[model samples]
Target: MAGKELHVTDIFLAVQVEAIVAREGAIMAVEKGFSNYVIESDSLQIITALRTTTTDRSVIGLIVEDTKSLMARVTGEVTTHIRRTANIVADCLAQFGRNIGANLTWFEEPPNFIIHLLFEDCN
Candidate 1:
């Protein structure tokens, strides 16, 4: 899933938005029948929140809880925080999505635009 689209009435902090997106990504992975997966985010705060077992009563409490529930259902789920420089492909795709103002998902293979970045990331 890509692009920024939140059908909410109130303004959310950046960390909250990142948490929401992480939750959505987890949901998609589970729906696609992925039993093992690694979720990486540039937001260390969100990653830390997900790693914790305690209940979060903050503004993003519900989103974090739901994400944890999804993670529990997976067989081997890993969540980590990486610097944005280490995730150039995701960053580029996110920028592309924002430019187009639409949400997009690509399975099996990514779009042509980020192919080189993906290769570079792997190497």
Candidate 2:
């Protein structure tokens, strides 16, 4: 298991940022040679955009399209919508990343700060 936290300098809308994050995550997964993976996001719009065949012409259309292209390269790829309430660990990590303003990756285990949240999430 691994987690990635990216800090972006440019500002974007919430949905756009979500799309960018999803795209980046997909890229990372492909780079790591993950044949099967799941992409979960609290943004329903992003999940819906990915699962659909229609083109998105909005501000995030390009990012969404690129994300879809990457998703095609992986076998058994699953994208799903998760409630923010159920995604505490991700939210905490995102905040932590923003606060430090750096890109971080953790392999095999999560950061100590979010360990408790992970346990709670499991429950």
Candidate 3:
């Protein structure tokens, strides 16, 4: 069975940190020993950049670089782009983070309020 796991991080940034969340997911996969897995994101551009050798020079590029490097540390890793509608848990978690004003949060199990969403997604 897949052990329950959730990670959320927030930081005060002067600039936009759009792609960094994807990077954080990569970082989590490596740190948590996800040997064979597919990482999904709503952003196609971020997923494409991760699958290419092109250099990213943007402010969040360093984070993306770190993500790429971390992805390399594991085996059988795949990245895919998904629609936001299919990623409701992640979307809710992000909103939860913002609402709670938490700089960082990790949920070893599903959050209580999201139980219904999880059930709905099953169908």
Candidate 4:
């Protein structure tokens, strides 16, 4: 991790659970005291997932609800973006995910063994 705690700048809200997961993270941040945030992402799937309501009301629904509720509390507006270049921070975070390995330990810091994962097939 960096010496300074990073803030959620822009978020990429989409229909995909991955995007929702990021939104959920943003929501969690706001709950923790962040007054504003931006969601940046390039996935159309994730965007649609967030805007539509499906029958799949399992854990994902709970996440969506919790995220929505959290977003509702934010004084700032939730924004969206479609360009990959526009989402450097999120992409960086996703790259961080690549380092976490298969068994994702959300609460744990990413390990160095996973560094190679970032360079693999990276465009």
Per residue, candidate 4 scores C-alpha lDDT tens digits across 1-123 of 211123333444434446456566665556567566555457654544455556337445666555566666777745565787775554655655445444333323544433454555433
lDDT accuracy of residue 107 in candidate 2: 68
lDDT tens per residue, model 1, 4-112: 3334335458787688788887887788888786888999888999999999888898999999999888898899899988977767665555566556666765567
Poorly placed runs, candidate 4 (over 4 Å):
1-17, 48-60, 101-123
- Give lDDT tens digits, candidate 2, residues 1-95: 77788878676588988898889878988999888778889999999999999998989999999999999999979999999988777787776
lDDT of 4: 0.52
lDDT of 1: 0.75
Measured with C-alpha atoms, the lDDT of residue 56 in candidate 1 is: 84
Better of 2 and 4 by TM-score: 2
Model 3: clashing residue pairs? none
Count steric clashes of candidate 3: 0
> What TM-score, to 2 decimals, does candidate 4 have?
0.50
Q: Candidate 1: where is the Cα deviation over 4 Å?
A: 1-11, 116-123
Could you tell which candidate, 3 or 4, scores higher by TM-score? Answer: 3
TM-score order of candidates, best first? 2, 1, 3, 4
Computed on alpha carbons, the lDDT of every model, listed in order, comes to 0.75, 0.84, 0.65, 0.52
lDDT, residue 117, model 4: 42
lDDT of 3 by residue, 9-109 (tens): 56455222436666666667777787765678887777877888888786667777888888888898888989988987876656555566445535456
TM per candidate comes to 0.80, 0.88, 0.71, 0.50
